[model samples]
Target: MAALILFSVTVSVISEKGEPAADLLRENVEALADNEYGHNIYCLGYGSLDCPLNDRKVKVITGEY
Candidate 1:
């Protein structure tokens, strides 16, 4: 689930950038994905490893990008 969302975002974001920046974004998104599973790491926010649970569901909260 999460991986699916990220894959789409990665493609769209990188596609817009030049090779160098795109490469960097690819690496960052790859690091976020641990495996084939949809699982994702919780990015530390403002010195804490937490964000509102609602924030995690980007798709449901916001319309298609």
Candidate 2:
């Protein structure tokens, strides 16, 4: 008998530069993570670490798919 084991994780990063930057960062991270882990570790979401609710600041970034 033979079996295969696979591992996967969802990553979320905090960014201060808004959704655009967060999207870029997430893309980069996903690539690096896939290489590091030898699997597709996708970044599922992103959010601002320090942005306040009413500050007209960056909001949480979510994956479209």
Candidate 3:
């Protein structure tokens, strides 16, 4: 069986409250995944480390927003 390797890139953003916003971060992540490059990138919010808004397969890492 061939293993499929996906490349995920995390983009961090700080909110007004100084907390990671999962929703907003997911939006940016989704946009990257939708890009034409097809690099399989995922957006990780530095604030919302506890709960990620994006898909589990996308590999969302949150920290230090």
- What is the lDDT for 51 in model 3? 34
- Each prediction's RMSD over C-alphas, in Å, is 13.1, 19.8, 18.6
The TM-scores, one per candidate, come to 0.28, 0.23, 0.23
| Residue clash pairs of candidate 2 | none
Task: Quantify all predictions' global Cα lDDT against the true fold.
Answer: 0.50, 0.35, 0.42
On the 0 to 100 scale, the lDDT of residue 59 in model 1 is: 23
lDDT over C-alpha atoms for residue 14 of model 3: 43
**Candidate 3, poorest ten consecutive residues by summed lDDT:** 1-10
Misplaced by over 4 Å in model 3 are 1-21, 36-65
Best by TM-score: 1
- Write model 2 residue lDDT over 1-65, tens digit each, in one string: 01111111222122332423446545765565553332332332344542222333344522322
lDDT of 2: 0.35
Candidate 1 contains a number of clashing pairs equal to 0
